[model samples]
Target: MKKEFAVIGLGRFGGSICRALAEEGMEVMAIDVDEDRVNEFSMIASHAVVGDTTDESVIKSLGIRNFDHVIVAIGDNIQASILTTLILKELGVNKITVKAQNDYHEKVLRKIGADHVVHPERDMGRRIAHNISSNNVLDYLELSDEHSIVEIVANEKLSGHTLIDLDIRAKYGINIVAIKRRNDIIVSPLAHEEIQTNDILIVIGADVDIVRFEKKVMG
Candidate 1:
């Protein structure tokens, strides 16, 4: 059986999650305080409704606690977001993910029992900055303050060298987990496999190590 998901607050973030879940064939219930927003997703989501999520009665009457996971994506309204999350936690929802506007909001959400809290705007800003700063870097995902996964484009210096020949792990302390060539992807590439220029290397390691590897090898 497909897991059930509930997304409250039909703003850009919530709408995107609902659409993505529906695209993956999951049963998604989209909720919003705005009637127009709810109507927009009526056809895309398994269910769509408009109600104030801050009211515990509204949430319980809608059977929201039964969902496998619930996401609070309320925008701008910090009080509403916090209240909704608190209500969900009290209702014994198994998992509740909340979108926080800032670090202080995230801390409060965590204290109030949000299973996960995301600062999407701040994270996106960092990713954009990284991409623009390094021409060799195609993409960046921050896993922690110290660690990240980056996609780097191979240059002429790495055109013919194999993984073993470069000794990347020993020298740079980073791992090239996969290589993307044109439309194909090579996962856990073998040591003897030679790297081709223009290949996209998906590497993971501490942030400092990844930066060193990108500068030395992909420059």
Candidate 2:
């Protein structure tokens, strides 16, 4: 059965999530205080309503707790965002994900029983910064403060070398989990498999070790 979702606040983050959920054939109820914002999603979401989520009565009337998931994506309004999340929790919403404005906001959301809190803007900024700094780095995913997984574009220096030949694990303490070559993805690649310059290596390891590997091999 398809899951039902209610996304409160019709800003960029919430709107994008709503559309993506709808595209996956899930039922999405889009809500916002602004009538214009609600009207805009009438065709996109299963139900679009102009209602302030801060009000407990409105929350009950909308039956938000019945949805499989609820997302609070209030824009710039920290008070409203926190209030909405608190009300959702009090109403026994199954799962709640909130978009936090900053570290302080994230802390508050966590305390209020938000199942997940996302700092999308901060994460995107880090990703973009990493991509721009290294010519071979295609993307970066931070697993923790000390570890990360990065997509590195295979350079000529790495080409024609098998995993066994490079011994990346022993030398750099990083593991190449997969290799992406255009349409093909080789997961848990064999040690004997040779790398091509066009391949994108998906590697995971300690941040320092990954940087060492990138600089020593990619350059």
Clashes of each: 0, 0
Off by over 4 Å in 1: none
TM-score of each: 0.94, 0.93
lDDT of 1: 0.95
* Model 1 lDDT-worst window of ten: 210-219
Top TM-score model: 1
Look at candidate 1 and tell me the lDDT of residue 78: 98
Q: Which residue pairs show collisions in model 1?
A: none
Model 2, residue 154: C-alpha shift (Å): 0.8
lDDT, model 2, position 177? 100
Candidate 1 structure, TM-score to reference: 0.94
Instruction: Give the least accurate 10-residue stretch of model 2, judged by summed lDDT.
Output: 136-145
lDDT of 2 by residue, 75-166 (tens): 99999999999999999999999999999999999998999998889889988998999998989998876899999999899899999999
